[model samples]
Structures are given as structure tokens and as C-alpha cells.
Target: MVSTLSRRTLLGGAVALGATGLLAACGRGGSPTSAQPGSGAWTFTDDTGATVTLDARPTRIAGLNDAIASLWNYGVTPVASFGFTGLADDVNFRGKDLTRVTEVGTTYGEIDIEALVAQQPELIVTHAYPKDSSGTLDPQKPLYGFADLKQQQTVAGIAPIVTIAMSGSAADVVERTVEFAQSIGVSQEALEQPRRDYDAARERLRAATASGLSVMAVAAYPGEGVYIAKAPDDPALLSYTELGLNYPDPGGSDYYWQQVSWENILDHRTDVVLYSLRAMSGADMQQQPTFAQLPAAEAGQVFPWEFSAMDYVAQARTINNLAEHLEGSRKVT
Candidate 1:
């Protein structure tokens, strides 16, 4: 037996393992509860299940990782961002608007706590959670479960931390974002349009899947290792599968994606290589041995992607992104 499994089933089992007691805790107020504070401020559950309260709609925000990309997609401009080395030119938002934003330093591993505190942003967003090797949430400073929320609190002080899951379906992203906006005082009237538009985009992508193309998304430079963006039970892949393209089959217990080598990647024979760059440029990818040797590279089939597109919400936008990027490149037509 191949022993295929689903992440939802596993997480669901874990949820069930503790649900009875957790539910009791929730009823007794030991658990975090969602609350609306004001017209522009509210409280929502960060990914770590911690309650976060925003004082108001923040005009000054700092983003770590692709959270800025997600915010920009929502039309909210951030004042500053972390990790803008070779990427200051293009990817989505420009660093020119980020001058006043200040560099809070890089993302992942050890965060630049001092610079982040100096920024004094009203909002801070990141993508991963702060956990010890045990995978338990670090209790210090009330770290939010999600990385975006934790980074926000670290920078914004007492500002309500929000962790929007930018790695899910468009509807999932929109729903979470609306919940976030609502918590922060965005009125229903203001959210209705985006909610509708995002849903429309999702539907369009799903419908277009029938005509979808085979896309193999990975980091062009595999120095740290090649990252394959395949989520276990990720609905986003449905769009690609619908588009008639084969996404890389994930390894067991590997929900996020895989970091593989050029040898392992040959198993898929992926047609289109979607590459992600952070602090590096597309031109820099030529220096990578694996990337240089791949047939996809030899055929001029490599497509440069952004760090933001490597996550879950990548479905709705990445589809369109892949289609557009592929249009200009040579394919096996």
C-alpha cells in the first residue's frame, strides 16, 4: 500500500486529541476569544490561537517575508519591509515607498529585535511562528502562533497582531483577511467588495484549471536547498491540477513542501520551473549548479518567482502569475 494520508486528517486527529479539554478551557476563559473593540480596532485569533487586539486600522505597517506582498495585493501599503536585498526593484511593492519604513532586518532564524522595536510600527507581519525545537509556542512576550502575528507584536509593541494565512485558497485568504479587517474596524461595506472580488477570482481560477498547464515551482537556486511548494491536501493544487498541470507529489508527513536536490527533482520531469528569490536576483540563479544543469534550464523553461508566491495563497495568484510568465518564455509547443 502507498499509504496516502491527508494533513487535515492528521491535524484533525490532533485537534481531537485535545479538543475535549481544550473546549473546556475555552469555556472557562482559559482560551483566547475573538472580540470587536472599535470601528477600526478589534481582536482576532492569531494562528497560534492567541487573541490579538488592534487599537485601530494601522496606516504604518512593517512586513517580514511575503506578508508585505499579501498586504500589497490587498492594496494596503506597508511603511517598511524586511529582506530587500536583490529584490528591491521588482516582485510586487517597491522599496522606494519603504524608505521611511526602515529595515527591521532579515526574516527567519534569529529576528532583529532591536531594529524591530525601533520601527514602532502599528502593525508587524511575518510568516512563521516562534517555537523551540519542541514545537511549543514561546511564551515570552506573548508570541502569536503564526509568524506574521508574532513579528507584528515584536515590532508594534501592544498593537493587535494579525496573522493572515496567505498560503491558502483565495477564498480562504480573503475570509481570514476580512476577519482581520473586521477585527480592526473595517466595516462590512468596505469588505464586501474585496470578499466578492476574491471569490470571483477563485471561481475563475477553478474554472480555468481545465486549461491549466503543468507547472513545477521550486527555488531556482538550491544553495539552502530547492523548495517545492506542495501542501499536503492543499486546495491550491486543485487549480493547477485543473489546469492540466501536474504539481509535484509530496512526500509523507510533508505538508508545506519539499527541499530537494536536482537528482530527486528529476523524478517529476516538471515542465515549468517556477523559481523563488529572496535577497537574490533571477540573474543570480545562473550560478547554481542544479539550476544550471536541469533540462528545464537548458530548454529556457525556468521562470523566476517571488518568495511570497511560495506559500499557500499562491493558488489564486500563482496560477495567473504562471500563465503570464509562461506566455513570454519558450515552452514545448
Candidate 2:
């Protein structure tokens, strides 16, 4: 979750826990319960293969903004949520309401631990990557409001945290999210229509990709620079490729993107650019002197790349929108 400095300031915390205790506090565990007939206990195996059990289904859930949106699609809303930088103005969240949900913090680390703890969440849900080679979770990964180790330990002590994996494709993330939703008692019937809609949208994307307009996803930086998304590292981009989209790889071992100066932006030419909505806007890019030199920019073949979309509806919308762009694009490079 990238953000400007104003939106990403780290909040101060006094408490600290040892690394072992921190892992233990954040580790998975569930309690037995008799909340409902045939629903003895709630247990979930997260992306890291950690199992968390709860005595009863979680009614009061806390999550990151994207996770909250995912849960909303399943008719389950979080009691509290944390947002990334510029959250109030985030184009991706347009038309969505976050009024009733308590705000814990922003992506740059402004966590209100007292407020979050006041929510009394039975479960805390957020995205997580697999354990590093050292078999430990990395706080640097965008797991939620816990960007800092001290913050993570402080929050972990408030309630059980369920870290869903973000390393797989968007489809994989959605599937795991669905399972988590089901464990919390969201009905399968509620998911049926969304699944169908997603399938339809996916087919549209496939058909559009058949047009062969080379595409690239990128985010602009302050210093006349751009970060071209490395398809393999981005689940959404990977999913697009799986659907037959010809997104060029920037050819680097970087986890998610290849940073390059704007002077070199045209080196990775494409017919279309999926610009990051979380970063710079179209107008912002237009201000860049070299941006107009890019074929995609000159042709006005830019579309919002909503990399944080988690719900079926949002995913479907993104696919359909990209399909429209692909269908209309002309080969420029």
C-alpha cells in the first residue's frame, strides 16, 4: 500500500514484545464453541498454513479497507477498518461508504490502537504473504495496519488476527476470502450470483485480450520516475495474463515492479497503460514532460489499474472496464 508521506506517517507506540512472543501472539489458534447446531467451532488455515480457531463465529470483525470491502460483498461488514493513504479520496472507493465502520489507521501507520481495541473485534482479518525463508512473517508486507512490529504485537494482543495470503492470483485471494466468509456464516447462496458475474466478466476479458493490444501496468513517482509492474509479482496482472492479455514483463527479479526514469518509460512500450489509481492520476501524469512521448499516453490509452480490488463486484467491474479499453485500443507500438 504505497502512499504519500502525509498519509504514511508512523504512529508512536511504547509497548514492545519479543520476536518469539510477537509471533506467538499473532499465531493461529481457535477455541471450541457451540454457537449453532452443526457449527461447533470456526477454524481457518491462512495463506501461510497457519490455523486459527475461534469458539464461535466472529460477529465483530476488523479488517483492512480492502478486506472490509471483500466481506461486504458476502453481506458481512467489518466493525472497524484501516485504510491506505489518501483513503478519503481514493478513486477505487468511490460510491462506497465507510461511515459506520470505525477507522483504526491509515496505510502509512496512524493506528488508533485504543479505538481499535474499543471495537472488541472477535477476529481481525487482513492480507498476508507467506513466511519468509526464515519461517517468520514480515511486517513490511501489506498485511494491514500493523506495518510496525510493535504495532503488530500491540494489536495482536487485542484480538486474534487472521492473515489471508496475498501472494497468489486475485482469483486465489477471492477463493480464500470466500472460504473465510463461509466460516463466518455467510451463505453460499449469497455467493452464487457473484461467482456467475465474475465468470461472465472473465470471459469478456479473455475475448478482449484476443485483440492483442500489448498492455503494461505502472505507477508514477515524484522524481520523474515510473514503476512498471512485474506481472508475476502482481496477482491482478498475473490474472490478466492468465486471461490471455499480452502484458510485457519488465524482466527483473524485483518483487512487484521495475523502477525506471521517465526518460526510459518508452523502453517498455505498449498499446495501453493500466495506471495505478493509488499513485498518480491521469492529470498528474499529463504534467510530466516525457509522459506525452509514450505511445499509450499520446494515444490516450490509459485506464485505472485497481490493484487493491478484493470483492467479486470490484473484480468484475475492473475486468469489464479493461475489456472495454482493450476492445477500443489501437496498436501503437
Candidate 3:
């Protein structure tokens, strides 16, 4: 089980003042110390072509659970957030202090309206995907940690929603998100180093991929099957392709992944395997008889990958991790 940071520990100085004072200090009641609401009104256009306007620069902010970490890294910590189930056990949040933020809900489509309203957020941030003609997100899939349209309506009643597009290349998404953060008062200075780090990491990965090593990104569903990620459908995978990593198209009608049985996993052979960190463990994969047959698996070239990373720091870390994995790997397929 993953250990969680407690509220008292994270908000040491403010905890002594009690919940009300702590909430105020955390940018809940009035303007944040770092960013004061300017004389002019604040407005932003979301990816869905919807414009959100505010009377004052929103100091009390709320976000989807996954988005909170990214926002915090960009110097815009949220006062409240809704998370997916088992969020406390997520390794990505380990050692991170989120105790000052109130958790509004634990699963998608389920929100604690009372708790959210209590936080009195003036702005809400989340990710948006391209919508089809029928008014559904592309691929008609549910985004992790995001609520459905009906549930979103409820939240909208409380505050204007600002969304960053989760589609397109990872760099595009990261850039747009940073732009959004800046519009809301996060300083460019705070974002400089992370951007520089990402750029440097990208160059390093590009050099590593020049060796023509093919990488296959996949998620294993222990008892069900394997879902091979396709570059065109995944932002992160597309960014990898742009960085020079060779990922073969899984040619199919599906916009996202190509589902394959465990027995046929080797059909899409490659030199390196970028497996999902959220899925079955590396030990579990190695224990499978079919997994033992793959050259990449046998050579131990599998590296953990997270497709949902939305911030510069996380993306930079991901690039560095991939570069390290490919350091001594050779083409095996």
C-alpha cells in the first residue's frame, strides 16, 4: 500500500489556525498572495470553443485529480479536486503533499457537490478531447478522472470550467496547458526550467532513437488481453514518434489501441517495450509463458510509461526515463 501525506503534515504552519484559516491561506476566500486579482476581468477560451469569463482573476481554483498535480507544478495549486478510485495508492502521487486540497470525489461521474461548493472555487480546470458530430468526445471513450456531460453540468453551475485539450501531440498539449496556466496568473519564470529540461530531454531521446530501435507501447490486462497503443491515437505516443522513436502503426479502424490476445502479443514485435505503469507489474509480465517468447521481453528492454502525464516536469522526466532505457538497447526485431 502506498503511504499518503496527511493534511497536518503538509500544512504545518496553517494547521495551527484551524480549517477555516487554512482554507483562506490556501487561496480559498480571497486573492492569492502570489497572484492578486487585477483590475480587469479574467476570461479564457477552452478547447471546446467555449469561453469562460470571471469577474476577478479566480484565486480559488479546482481541478480534476490528475490535473491538480500538473497545476501545482506550474504554480497554480488547486483548493479542491476530484480523483479516480484508488488515487491514494497511485505511485505518481507518492511523497507529494496534497493534504491542503480537499478531495471532492473518488471516482468519475461521482462528485461531492457539497464539499466542492464548500471550497467555493471560482474556476475549475480539466482536460477536453475532440467531440464528434454527435457531441461526444472522439473515440467516444471516458477520460480517466473526468465526469460525464450531465455531471459536468452540475459542476458548471458552481463555476466556469476551463479545459485544456488532451488531444494532439504531447508537446502541443503541454504548451497549451502552460499557456492556460499563465493566463490564470502562473509566472513564466516558474515554468522556464521545466520547459528547458523537456527540450534538452527531447534532444537526448532523439539521439537515442537514431539507432532505429522500434518501440511498442502496450497495456496488459492480466486476465483479459493486451492493448497495443497506436501513435496517431495517443498524444504521448505521437510525441515519441516526433522525437524519432520508431513505433509501427497497428493498422486498424480503432483510433486508440489495437486489442490482441496474449498468445498473439509477439505479432507486433519490436526492439523495446514501453509498457503502462498503471497495468500489471513487470514481474507479472515476465511470469507469463507467452511474454517470455518476445525478444524485447527476453532482453529486459521494457520501460514503464505513463500516457496521462500533462505537465512539463512529468513530461521531462518521462523523456529522460525513455532515454535511459534506450541507452544500451539494440534493435532485436
lDDT of 1 by residue, 208-321 (tens): 434434566554343445556563234344344544455656463444446566556555455567665432344565466655566666677777654332322333455566
lDDT of 3 by residue, 1-333 (tens): 101211111111001111110111111111112233564677776555556777667889987765666777776768987754434654445556768778887664578999999999998887544321122343233233444545666787888776655566778878777767777788878988988998998999999989889888777767756777777656677798998888998666654556777898878788888776656766688787887678899998887766444788878887888888888898788
The local lDDT score (0 to 100) that residue 283 gets in candidate 1 is: 53
Candidate 3 steric clashes: 0
Could you give candidate 2's per-residue lDDT for residues 291-330 as a string of tens digits?
Answer: 7778888899988776555667778888888999999999
RMSD to the true structure for each prediction, in A, is 8.4, 5.3, 10.0
Ranking by lDDT: 2, 3, 1
Residue 212 in candidate 3, Cα distance off native in Å: 1.4
Q: How do all models score by TM-score? A: 0.60, 0.84, 0.83
Arrange candidates by TM-score, highest first: which order? 2, 3, 1
The lDDT, on a scale of 0 to 1, for candidate 1 is: 0.45
| Highest-scoring model, lDDT | 2
Steric collisions counted per model: 18, 3, 0
